[model samples]
Target: MSEGTEPSSSSLALLHHHHHHPQQQQTPPPPPPPPPSTASPSVAGAIVRGYRKGNWTLHETLILITAKRLDDERRAGGSSSSAHCSPSASTPAAAVPRSAEQRWKWVENYCWRNGCLRSQNQCNDKWDNLLRDYKKVRGYEARVAAAHAGELPSYWAMERHERKERNLPTNLAAEVFEALTDVLGRRAARRANAAATPVSTLPPAPIPLSPPRFPQPPVIPTAPPPLPEPAAAAAPPTLPPGHPSASGTLCSPIDITRIHLEMSSDSSESENDDGAGTAEPEAKRQRLGSSVVRSATVLARTLLACEEKREQRHRELVELEERRLRLEEERTEMRRQGFAGLISAVNSLSGAIHALVADYRNGNHR
Candidate 1:
């Protein structure tokens, strides 16, 4: 057993079988590796992976978003010579207390302040996941909105809990939605909807041209009973001045009928006066309603006219700019032609001078 040479195959086989028995499989696995050095981000990342590898908690996510916003502000206002650059804007720098490793380590420290306990790598990973999920929710919302005729509902219009059977249409959680909204601002669709709300183009409801007619009282179809002869119904038989009827002490049939007819006419006239009184307020109300409608119409027309003028002004400016550019190009071409003509004239004069010099030389030689 203690020999230097390797053990025979049969002995090796027996040892392997003895150690790998099914009963031994129930034993616990080995302990995880010791935490790594923090000397480098690479090693630090490994330690984070080993320490706490799980889904981010909601409070931790909120902290991350808040910290990111603060970091951006601080970086944006930071001195160009010493500050780590904000994401898109930056200037030259030599060094600072710590490196801007992916511009995230400081944010990680911020999360740590809230007892988040996540490394920069974890923070980065979680942030990317949150964005990815947020985008997916946005896309789903867009698709849902497309089915309707008009603009989509705003993100903040509905509460987070109501977005599902409860929420508007997105199932994303309240914390995540709010965090993403704060970090990213409103989505494009939401912004567009908000922008379009003020420019309604449909004409205001048409105003009726004339005041409505008042309802006429129904006419009575049956004619009054034939009046008694004037002698009977018109005047109580000219009773003697001291007669009982004249003194109002008693009435004959003729006098009674005359009183009845006279009383009826008086009651009818009083009813007409009461009807006029009741009709006055109703007419005033109708006039008031019409005046309001007319004022609204005038306002709407004014707004439309202003909009048209703005569009017309824009068109004129665009046309003027085009004309200016065209004239500039033409002016450039004319200058180019003028320079060419000057060069051609100079060459022609030089040729004539050469011919003249030749003629003079010939005559002198002769």
Candidate 2:
């Protein structure tokens, strides 16, 4: 087909098909649906329990979820913020769909790694209901704590006081006169009694006209008495019989051995004393430890008692509120029934009066 002839429509179609058809290869089938997500049920359950127990906050859960999602995205070779030049070019990861249950799973895994939770089970609906009730209890506790903290005054007491003040009629004249008499009488009596009291006849104390004299001390200290000189050693006694020189010296050697033995006994006794001293301290420490344990146990029991009482009081309050509501409902129903009966009675009375009037007009009383 020459440019001048302008190719026919069928010829153009054939050329177009030839150019594009060969470039297209058979499309491969999509990889089998990703093997069911490998999420651990244990991790999910732990997250749920921890949240319900108030051990983990919602903020922390959100952080863990975000980190897990980002990690997952990275592993899947998804684009990150750095992959783009402009900040706006990358979509925020938070924009992705995130649910509470999904976040809980991430938190559970995080807690597991941190050793925050011990058990690994699926967080079931049971725990969810408990957590809801627990939140309500916590809210009531917070309100109580706030009231005790004096963030808001107790309105009930204030209202009671106001009512009392309003009911009591004031008498200004009587109050003022009584107040003046009570104050002035005591003051006048005090002044009169002071004036009537006798004065002491004792003379005034005398003052010295000259400077005080202090005791004087000698300039030099006396020398201490000299120590007495030690006595000279006595010569060894002469051998009595001279049967053998060694025998006489034998007694001397025996004396030296005795002295040595005495020194050794003293040392052993000192060691025994030292051991006894050390044992005393150890015994004292044991006693102190026992005392501390006793005190701690007492404190624990006191706190436990306080907590139990507080819980009991809250239960009573809830019961009272339910009872009040029930009573109000009953009262409302009774009032409604009373009104209906009252209207029926009025209608019946009117009918009887009308019948009596008709008989009177027709002389039926005859």
Candidate 3:
């Protein structure tokens, strides 16, 4: 009985060893420890879980997720969804992700890029209509983004069909049309106002009339009148003997005859002396002729000197006039150049002002 029991125990041990070894081989190494829990329940995880559990609405979920993603992307220096999702891409419009934060960012960027802040009611009509449609279709967030970007389908039959399917309101559509009409009216009014405005242009200055200067008549020197010829010197007269004639009686002819002979001799001597005096006057007349010639020569020299002085004065006046004309021409040229420069400056200033006004309106003043 002891020997039989020992054999049975060995068989049992063998059975146990075979069973354990096969089981160990078939167990598959306990499935490699379940890969560790990498996903932790942080704020983002809680939000995502809440969305999946229907604790948050679709729009709210989208908003929260978009905000989280954007923040992460920004930190990582990657593109934001709002910037990457453009309508020009081939991606279906509905396929684009829905997020309130992304929509808001898209709208803000669109308005800035297209200068919609200053846009008139008519300019904003399409966006308004799109918003209305989006609200009806539960796509308000998307509408907001598209409207902000100032992008809408063109006015056409296709757009109309799409709008109808989206259940857009007729009243809202009418408002958009009305806004366009208002814009047209305002533009027309502005054009009319511009036409009515008067432009001021200064009249050309009157041309001055200068008085003409006439040349004076030439002056001629007048000659002095010639003197009349002097009369010949009068002959000397003889006197009677006053003492003999005191008794009032003349001497006898015979007695006088003897005295007459002596008187005749005396008369001859006197006549010779008179002839010599007459010859001296002829010499004096010749000397007077030479003095008159000298005076005439001096008068001619004075007239020539006066004529030369007048000619010199006239030449100086002509030179001065020419110089004045040249100076005036130079001044006119300088004024023309200055006027051109002024016009260029005014144009540049106008352009700068326009750019500045545009930047301010777009909220880009900085």
Candidate 4:
């Protein structure tokens, strides 16, 4: 019985020794390292390639593998057509309908997850185009603010600013009134001056003509007492059969009167001719003066018209400048208000995110 008990004890000890060995206690190899997780970099490349081909989604692993194989093709190159490419296609189709804020968040996550080292400017340019579409759904001012914040594209910002300037209200009536006032005042002043000026209708003075002067000869007066005998009495001499001399020359009173009358007629005719010749030059000078006055009047009228036009243009420019300044002020005020709203919204969003993170951490801890 002792011998049988000894053998039983020895067998039990051997079993115990084997169970205590380090090799037997070792853990099985960790389930073969989880089969390397079939999802790979090729999957991401495939998704990008699908986007290039206008495919909204990629379901097959083969497509993903092909995308990985042709990774260089995804980059914009000479052969690639921008017309066929959709920038948003590079993102997951499921995320397309997300809000601008959500899209931005996803982009940030994507960069981080993929270990992309793109610059901030590159990120801004991408978001800018995305925000332009959001602007159509949102209002103009909201879109403008998003663009200014780098959430929208730079081109959209410029276009929106231009539109705002074009649509701004103009004060045309004020300009018109100012122009009218300046024109009417100048016209009224000119008319008043014209009315106050005296008009002269009297003929211009004739140029003075020097009178003809005759030299007076010295006068010698001789008083003769003897009376001359009649020539017919002294010459009554011969002529035997004809006594023509005796009838002597007795002057005819009618003949002398007729000769005097002829002389007076000649004098009257000469005086009339001289008067007509002297008046011609005076009439010509008067007409020339009238022409000069008329020319001056026409020139003054033309100058006044030109001045009035210039005054009107100046008034318009002034009004335009004022309107532009007012618009600038209004735009500045609007920008200030929008910035305030943006700041408030950003603060609220940040607080919400922080709260969400805190909740997640607490839940995890629990």
Candidate 1 TM-score, true structure as reference: 0.29
TM-score winner:
1
Worst 10 residues of 4 by lDDT: 201-210
Instruction: Tell me the TM-score of each prediction against the true structure.
Output: 0.29, 0.26, 0.23, 0.26
Model 4's alpha-carbon lDDT is 0.42
Give, for candidate 3, the lowest lDDT window spanning 10 residues.
198-207
Task: Sort the candidates on lDDT, descending order.
Answer: 1, 2, 4, 3
For residues 1-366, could you state the per-residue lDDT of candidate 4 as single tens digits?
999999999999988987888575455555555554456544664455322222112122122222222332332221234323465753454344335444343443344344443323344453332223232223444555666575544333355455446442222123332333444455455443342222121121111221222221222132222222442233222223222311222133332222223222222222334333333333434543454355446656776687657655755776799899999999999999999999999999999999999999999999
Per-model C-alpha RMSD: 31.9, 34.8, 57.7, 48.9
Question: How far does residue 190 in candidate 4 sit from its true spot (Å)?
Answer: 6.4
Instruction: Identify the superior model by lDDT, candidate 1 or candidate 2.
Output: 1
How high is the lDDT of residue 119 in model 3? Answer: 18
Q: Which residue ranges in model 3 land beyond 4 Å of their true spot?
A: 1-273, 354-366
CA lDDT of each prediction against the hidden true structure: 0.54, 0.42, 0.41, 0.42
Q: Write the per-residue lDDT of candidate 3 for residues 1-366, one digit (tens) a residue.
A: 999999999999988887879887668966765543333424433444221221323333233333333433342232223324564652554466446455444443334343333112222343444433333433333454568554654233235556565444423334433443444345444433332221110111111111122221222233223222231122122224232422222233332232233233223222334333333333333433343344344544555476457545654675699789999999999999999999999999999999999988889645
